[model samples]
Target chain A: MTDLNPSRMAMVPFVSVHDMMRIVNGDGVAETIAAIADRIEADFLRWEQFDKTPRVAAHSEEGVIELMPTSDGERYGFKYVNGHPANMGRGFQTVTAFGVLARVDNGYPILLSEMTVLTALRTAAASVVAARHLAPKDAKVMAMIGNGAQCEFQALAFHHVLGIEEVRLYDIDPAATSKAARNLAETDLRVVSCKTAEDAITGAQIITTCTADKKQATILTDNMVGTGVHLNAIGGDCPGKTELHRDILLRSDIFVEFPPQTRVEGEIQQLDADHPVTELWRVIAGKAEGRTSTSQITLFDSVGFATEDFSALCHVHEAALRTGFYLDLDMLADPDDPRDLFGMVARADT
Target chain B: MTDLNPSRMAMVPFVSVHDMMRIVNGDGVAETIAAIADRIEADFLRWEQFDKTPRVAAHSEEGVIELMPTSDGERYGFKYVNGHPANMGRGFQTVTAFGVLARVDNGYPILLSEMTVLTALRTAAASVVAARHLAPKDAKVMAMIGNGAQCEFQALAFHHVLGIEEVRLYDIDPAATSKAARNLAETDLRVVSCKTAEDAITGAQIITTCTADKKQATILTDNMVGTGVHLNAIGGDCPGKTELHRDILLRSDIFVEFPPQTRVEGEIQQLDADHPVTELWRVIAGKAEGRTSTSQITLFDSVGFATEDFSALCHVHEAALRTGFYLDLDMLADPDDPRDLFGMVARADT
Candidate 1:
């Protein structure tokens, strides 16, 4: 065999955090979120075509690491993400992710990308997509509790996709609120730094609770929330971790992504195993109702799903290729003689 | 946040295919196999400490892609691998893999390495580790039925770890046999290329079956096997895939990695659900017997477990850090303030 000169087939296109940030900033954060949201909505319509599996997670004392994999027959995608709220206190991001998309026919990875920035974008996009159906019509303000990594993205996505003009930010750490407030000031959306969660949600038709830390911590109580509010609950994602009070869950019309996972990880984990919740995809696909009554509270229990990541990955793969915002990573071994891997390695020495 | 200058912490050490070959050729195949075997043995001894899960697999008509994840409390590791026999006909590898090793405490990936070469080495090491206990004590001559990518690695591993002096190789494809024979010729061990499986196993104490691309095809029947021989069945992983006939499995004392997973994917898939197979860890841990009698036929139903990959990754993580045969990938977003993720991305525009 000829000496192993690695070819293009061996190189997977890798979009690092730098390029991911570039893709977000260059495309304009709101435009990127809207594009990804469109993909998410489109994929949601073809949900049955994809193989969906709940993320496999390893939970330790410090945090949890998860592998979320999904495939759409033609392509396969998976995200390696970690959630450690403690990480933030120690100068590490609370959540970080990377993903790979491979061709299902050959099982060769074609794209590798940092999903940190992209996940933030996707998470924000998912909320806006859900709110497009569930939020109170004429919703002008979004109350974003727990102003951290996802806060500004959520504000921008709402501004682009849902026509929300103002965002109210609140966090247990006032500094996090200031950081989020400062970032949102860069965008056209009016940013308000609230003193408390209750203050943030006041007069807001869409209240998004994304607080981190403390299992079973009720950031929003039944009395704190009024009627006709759409709640996008993205935190309290793991088992034994929940953010809402039980009374609030009983009053709301809940919607979830994959019941089995949502029951264990979402706010409904506080409720019964058989608590009725609408499938978000069904609502998006026009198979189920999203919001029917004017005075009804609709809650989107967003624990984050594989399909959302898969959708974002599909978008990034195409964008990276089109814009040349990726590096070729020599991640696979493609020998001239497929059966001569050892010979290829041996020849490499020469 | 300062304009996103990715720090060292943001970088993950990546061992690409080229560096993987350099590491393999730099360390020598036999020696590397032995070193990784030692790590596998050490990890197996503390087997109970690991959080073991059967690989999460997405099976398509063309092939299958699997994610194998395992954690040992402090550290986490996972491998992404795919198997498409048809890929070989299209000039792609039948199996390609890559893996990541991360700190469980902070949920940060420390190493990313091309696992195709490492997997070949680890697979061989695992077989040799099991054979050390189960193979005939005086085993010197070995027969490898499939002279494919793994054949040369298997020969070198056996030569270094088990002191095997000679190897007999055979493949349905004559060129594969010649390639394996040529690769083995470079080493001190004697190499014999044969046209048929029966001719290859003549007078051999250890018989290794590593053929691919078939479902339930019996490469080794009961009549071909002799008493007091060890069979390293490395192929036939995944459902509906088997190399040995039922009669051969009935006679041999079957040993497996993980029983629940093995019962579904290993040769034991052909056996009853209750078919008793000794866990290989017990034998290594001295809690169970290996080969009891001289005439006993020992068969290791190797489906390739996650711990084996985790052990290999741990080895690679250390080797890469030591030798610097790796690239530092800007895979993670390490913002100065964890809550300022949006600020970090926005500032990168400047």
Candidate 2:
């Protein structure tokens, strides 16, 4: 294999969902989350070099399909994600995604993996990465609002990445809350099921809202939040989907992924366009402050950025190669006779 | 298999590049070309219902990576393609691509295949579809400038779809011209290698320029273009990457797959944004006239639209299913407990 024939070089490796599941499972969730968080922070610090675009979305009656792409001269990563709110009714997930990472020099895919589980992992990793800088250092308790598929990842990430000792969970769906609780039953972190969103946030130093309704919903109002409560707002990503109340955004010191995208999709979308929100990368690069004072309210408005996917892709490319759990997809043409693609077809028949 | 459990009701077949090449070779190129051409034209006629967007591109110093996505309410398709002009120096093809087609209802990918070859096939099919409508009814000859990897597909498509009997080929690389000439030798259509671009277009009713330079190279200047010649501009797809002279665009009655995209990535990008160009769908829908007079020069400014991919995806989906040439990709999680993605991981490790 090291001889490096052009014909063998044409094959692209495809990482299946099963393969990705194995990689993540084999590596252990805590280690994978920590590794990806490190990657995200590293990628974010050098952010200006990337070619970024607000995702292109195709909206339908049921849901939306989006394509998010970014590149950094050397490699390009894109995630194809669909948000079908009604999919859960058919025993499918509300969000299902897959991503590709390619070498920009040759334009050949280096990684193709199921991002349904990986997205959950990266989103949680990103949230914790931001929270570590913005949340109080001694913050031991975290409140998680809207316990769904993403809830376990959030719970595990905060516990593993931020050293959160306790998690208070609440959701409209009791079954979803139970699922999160059952998933975390074997873990060391204490999981307390709360009756309501307010009950969950009562004594928690950090509040994480991850509700998935497409419509604007006030999961966290000003009355429910207090000083020094670091808010990690997820799930309020698309245009009309929001989680925090208007007053909560107005009162808190906010940090965001990309200002251009966060302004439209984050909790800050409820605020004015000129609102002085800190970019997360600036804090990672030591150019801006995070959690200025013990008593100051801080909010991490995370709508999931392409850079996080870029970082996760880099991590997965290395892991998949190390594990050799992927299949070699015949995804490119033979370079022996570049113009003889027709011959590939002709010879197959003969 | 037919008396399966309800969960396995409908199998969405997929075709890997290896299997697709086998199918194409087994069926014969002429037969495959005709079938693909038929699918393309039929799909083009119903283009109104499609969800179309200009491709999202991440451009680097050397090239660009783009995601072209579109849907027809029932099925969604997207192609990840890259154009690295410097890649040929690195012993890589200038363009490499792969794509997916998914059920809109379930957001489950039905077909995933290598588009490096399919792209060549579809791009040519699109040109032929446009030429069939935009070219003169009695057009029988084509002038193919920039005879490179795409020239064979163009020749075969034009021959099979537009009834083109002869092709005059010209390229900066004479070897490329000879390669194209040699590939088309097996076909009934006569291939003539010309010494210059002007000689190629001498008496042809249709002129197709499929050059590969990443810059604005004028393969067809206004002087070489005579009256009533339909220009199929196939290569000038990215911003600042153009093949035709601006004056040639100023003179011809242009038709495009998607006008907004053609304005930025096609030859029309050289013209003003306010330039009046008709959408090819309107002509296919019989709402507008095509090639009004034999003396009227009509041009199909092709940048390769996403809708064409949606059409091709459906064609591939059906073809692969009927022939049973697909690998089942474990891309989505159907947990025994749908909520227990972590359980899948835990079980895998055990």
Candidate 3:
């Protein structure tokens, strides 16, 4: 038998947080979000081709860690994400994530990347995709409720992808609203800082709620929401974490990413298990109605599905290849003789 | 507000294949296996403390990819593995794996390691752990029915951990037998290459069947097995794969890792759903009977479980820390203010 060097086969491209930041900045955050939104829209059009499963989660006293996996016949991808609401108080991010993409044919991982930044981009992009299909055609104003880590991305995605010209921001913490207002000062969008959620949603066509609390707090009540509005709820992702009141869901034509998952993790978790909700993919595929009438209240109960992460990973893998912004990580063991794994380890001694 | 740098919180230690090999060689494979086996045993002793679930798998036409996750109160771990029987024909491994270990409190990954080598070590160690409880006290010879990738590790583990003096090997392919024989040439134990399965198990007290076919080929029959022999079946891990005859399973007392998993993926998949089997942890925990008499036929229907991978990851994490054989991967996005994720990405531009 000839000695085969497994180093080449073992090398997997790794995009760290630093590299991910570079990739986002290199293309510009709004441009990157638009590109990922395109990918997400394309993937949603062919959603039936992908394998989708609700994320497997382990809930602890302090937080929950989840593994979300999906495949599109040709490629497979998964993301490891943790949501520790208390982590922020302990000088840690409330959410952190990483993902991998592999070939379905050979089951070899080709790319590993930090999804913390990518997920934020993808989440905002996904919201834009939903709003494009569900929102009123001439919608230009967006009310950003519970302004936090995701506020700037949401504002930009809507501004660049959905053409929203104004954003009204509000959070329980006055400092959070100020931070978001300061960040969006550079963008062309008209930014408004409000003292209350009710004030933020006034006269807005699009309302985005993305609070970071782990409890079931009603960031938007039934009386607060107005007619002919699109609600992009991003913060009520986990089991106990919900943003909108049950009355809001009852009044809206709810669109979800995946029903089985959204029924358990989204704002609709407050609704019945068998509530009639249209899958957003159906709207993208032109099989179902997104927003039937101008006065119809539309709510996108976004829990962030696995396919979105897969699309984000696909985008990152392509960007890494095009820009050369990644390191090759030797993460797999490939011996010349596949059966000679023990021999390879033994030879390492010499 | 203070500017906080999250780079330190984002860095996760990664042990590459080269680093894994260095750690294994530094501690010696057999010694490492013994230490990991000790950890596995200790974990099994407290089996009820863990949150166990069947692996989440995505099966394709060519192969299956799976995510196995388990968590104790303090820590969580998961392994990503794939089984593609045709991969070896294409100059790739039949199986490749990697794993991560994280702190449960913050849900942040602390370590990532290549598990192809660590899996080989853990499988052998797990086998030794089972053999110690199920195999006869005076068992010395082990009949290895399949001389494939896992052959040498199994041999060395039994030889070193269980004091097995001889290993008789047999394979349908002569080259596989020769490979196993050649690899074990430097060991003190006697290596006997036999022509057939029947010849290999002639006078052995323990029989190990580890063939890699994805079909139900009976490597062992009821007629071939004697009274007191312990069977270690490792290869029939997925559905439609079984190494031993159903009649042999009917005759022996079965012990399995996790019943829900073993029932679907282990050799016991050949049996009825209601077929009784003892959980292996019970035997380790002194809660159940093992090897009632010298004549009792004990069959350990081994299907790899998540806890085994967790133990293996735990072992690798410690070894890497002790030997400094790992790289810090910037996989998470940490900002001084947890809510200012967009700010972190924006600052990278300047």
Q: What does candidate 1's lDDT look like per residue over A199-303, in tens digits?
A: 899889999988777589998999998999999999878898888999999999999988989998999999999989999999999999999988999999999
Report lDDT per candidate: 0.92, 0.83, 0.92
Alpha-carbon shift of residue B174 in model 1 (angstroms): 1.3
Task: Give the higher-lDDT candidate: 1 or 2.
Answer: 1
Instruction: Give the TM-score of chain B in candidate 2.
Output: 0.95
Q: What does chain B score (TM) in every candidate?
A: 0.98, 0.95, 0.98
Indicate which candidate wins on DockQ. 1
Candidate 2 pairs with clashing backbones: none
Please give me the DockQ of candidate 1 compared with the native complex.
0.83
**Model 3, backbone clash pairs (residues 3+ apart or across chains), number:** 1
Error of 2 at B51 (Å): 2.2
Error of 3 at A107 (Å): 0.9
| Candidate 2 lDDT score relative to the true structure | 0.83
As a whole number from 0 to 100, the lDDT of residue A105 in candidate 2 is: 72
Q: Write the per-residue lDDT of candidate 3 for residues A70-173, one digit (tens) a residue.
A: 99999999999999988988988888999999999989999999999999999999999999999999999999998889999999999999899999999999
lDDT per residue as tens, model 2, A1-350 = 11223366677777776788778888988889899999999998899988877888777888888888888878889888888888777767778788888988777887777787788899999999999899998999999998877888888889998899999999998888888898899999999999888889878999998888898998887888899889999989988889988998888999999889989888788887998999999999999999889888998999998889989988988999999988887677654556556655555532
